[model samples]
Target: MAQAGEQAVGIDFGTSTSLLAVGSGVGPVDIAPLGRTTRSFPSIAGYQQGNLLVGEAAENLPIAQVIRSVKRAITDCSETMEISDEHGTRRVDVDEVIVALLAEIGTRAKAAGRPLDTREQVRLGCPAMWDGAQRQRLLDHAQNAGLPVAHSTLIDEPIAAGVAWVRHRYLQYGEQVEGRLLVFDMGGGTLDIAVLDVVGGPHPEISVLSALGVQLAGDRLDTAIAGEITEELAGQGIRLDGLPEAKTVEALVLREARTAKIQLTTQARHRIVFRGLARTQLPILTYTREQLEECFRPQMDQAIGLVWAALRAAKLTELGGHAPDKLRGMNGDRLAADIDYVLLAGGMSRVPYVERRIGELFPNAMIYDAAGVAADELIVAGLADPVGYDRLNLHRPGFDFVLEYTESGRKITEKIYPAYTPFYSPEEAWTNSYLGFERRGDDFPGPKRGEGVLRVRSTSGDYLALRYDGETKHGLRLQLGWNMLFKIYCDGQILITDGARQTRKLRVHQWPVVRGNGHAELVLQRVDDAPPVPSTAWYLEKEYAPPGL
Candidate 1:
């Protein structure tokens, strides 16, 4: 719920462009005009005349002075950008640039008659592959830019796009839509895919089955097209390699390639011209849809592969397995058949070739292109929607908890909690009994009168060492469980209900400034300064093993 005189705000802080929308908690969300005639503000900024400029104003600066795709740089762990201009080179913090751009967005929103209030609820969108660290970074930046938002207010970009699609269909048909939906969001920096199950009624319920993302999208395509143009120029003996402003020329070529790419979405061909380079004017070139398709095919194939991977992950979730190949009778065709609708979103989704390829892949599923509603507006609209905003059930982190130990002179990794497990739902809390520490041979006495370490690992390479100190004659039976509050506990017993047992829960002591593959980093401090002895005697009992053991 929003406060009085407050409008809900949704900010899609995208890689290439950022958009803002505001609603009065009653009517449809209105896309705020960032500029006089543009709804989107370029995700770029620069310093001109010793003052910071953002969006279109920054676009007017020299390519070397301007920083483009700041969102992508943030995701890639970039901390600073060097802007070289007539005033000389100066190092600028990436966070400062992001905050400046966001502040400008807020300024424009106010000018559009939708003044952003700190009491109003604000939702920000991030790529699906971004882990907790990245999400928190964005939240901090937003708050620094005077936006009222928290970590809980951050939503996955693809999930927000899905909500937008669901809302659009519900409004268009005047009926609630229910089915399995696959949202493909190919933005400038990343391609995010989400498979969701929607239950339509007076109160809609949306559940995300699986979600995945890759760092391949419109920017990569732009780079590919630019590379092709460079090669063509090289073949024509028009070499810019030894030129004084090679970097400037390269930047100009990339900008033109991006413009051509956007124009080719509507027209079959686009004419690109590179001007204002360091004393040399490159010839105008004609870029056709076919040529664009050629540049996009390989990346599209990779994106399609990621879609299949996401589908397989979803199927694994439905089938209650740790791996896709371990599930019986599972294939691509079955996965494709299970999808009821495919929602294309993001700026890259506007490409006709991308739409056609998706249609061909999922022939049976109904395809909803973003052309009907502008791609840039989808996330913000969904964020501001009161109905969908309240009912949306965003998917939790998709990461597997694994236990690694040495058994019989070989290293073994056992998945304790499979990916997509509903750890946040009390009714869906899962328990695994596959963890055990026993006396294997004379070499291993099962932590007899000494402490041993049980290494707990995550799919994202985060790990924790659980120390077990006790004297067990027979063995130690370990049970791992995840509660509704996103907490994981490991209870170790001496094979007797009333016997000596140690229960340890790994909780985040402090938020670590580390990044991972969409997985929360498990940070825990050692109880003692002593070195932990690796528990090589631990093994998983076959009787209690889950599928894909």
Candidate 2:
């Protein structure tokens, strides 16, 4: 159990930077690496023969030995990476390196006064395409590190992102929401879109329409710009791609270049010093925005094309020709083509051109009204909030996710969490409701008693009421924090089971009462001798109430 004020944080491990946030009301409140401008440690890790170095300290090692882009290796299983420092080179498994990074993050979490890993509450975001094996390996690695990892879930980056966008715009610090919406998550590695039908008649129907995992992102555009610089430098009779030494110098020069590339989109032109390995003073490289856009224009178009694909899927979701129609969420009616709104997320979303391109392609939709951020950060924030999904559902057109598998070494398609049921509840925090993936009905396994996944994201001193799909069962509450005598209850069974922050002298309703109706009553249960909050909640469709409620 976690402290009452604690948050089940969401971690976004990106190629360039990684971040963590707790609950929605307060914030991700950046956890800085020691002695920096409150910036996160670079994902880069450096190994000096025997010792290990992570973040800025690791930069001391030669660039080659300092593994900077660990995100690239998450998908591949049979990959072996080697880094060398003058004296010798060593080999490390990619997953091991990833774990090392996570261990450092755990350290960061402890420093922040919120140790999610130690507390066993955290939702991890992964590329949408990460498979069972990939997810399993990453989860194993996380568990190995003292990540508290009590309940670690693999959320697709895009979906996590979509969830975030929803929070940014709709969820008020102290409130409950109801509705349908859309989430667009474009990040350093991929672009994802979801149309959520949040759960409940008004608040829980968070069904995902589709999650499109794009292979291209900021890195691709950066590479295109780098390629152009190389070509231009080569034409200047400066061979940046010729000799190995020359390539090294060129790589280093471009090191400070992409930041400039991103800057160029907003700034007219950025200055650059291209060095020459052959002629000590001759290979200096310089650049301008015109040259960048000329080279990266194709990649930019590709990104726009991908966004179009997402919009098309969203259209299908609204129309219900898709599997979601079977869910019959949208009043048994199809939505209009012109969507209500479109929200943006991820670091790349900050790129001036990205919004422009998105606007051009998806003129029918308006960008989320929330403050903009790196494409990935939005999702990180959303994940921190319990009501993140609810906000989007209430504010936007709607979102959805399409599940897929591969056969004969090829990708297969399936619509598991259709857009019609976006906010559907899960069994345990460890379970995913894509029944086929992690759960099943009574037909296959044990009698399918209600396995409810009631997740509520929030910040400190904040209270929430969640009604799941069952009758009032016994009440259950697990509090790692204060022990309040009276908490909130719903249907007179489950108790809110946490903080007395809002318990008023006048407002008796403010007491932690489990609020709402569902198939299973959401109750905080005292399975054992635990008090304050029970270990869990059970909503009973039949007859279920607390011992004395």
Q: What's the CA error at residue 211 for candidate 1, in Å?
A: 1.3
RMSD, each candidate, Å?
A: 10.8, 14.8
Candidate 1 residue runs with Cα over 4 Å from true position: 1-7, 24-27, 87-91, 327-329, 397-544, 547-549
Error of 2 at 246 (Å): 3.6
Candidate 1 lDDT tens digits, 175-237: 588889998999999999999888654345677766788789999999999998898788777
User: Which candidate number maximizes lDDT?
Assistant: 1
**What is the per-residue lDDT of model 2 for residues 76-174, given as tens digits with 9 covering 90 to 100?**
454657766665656766776788888888787677666664343477777655554565666777878766442124466666665555444443342
- lDDT to native, each model: 0.66, 0.49
All candidates: TM-score: 0.74, 0.63
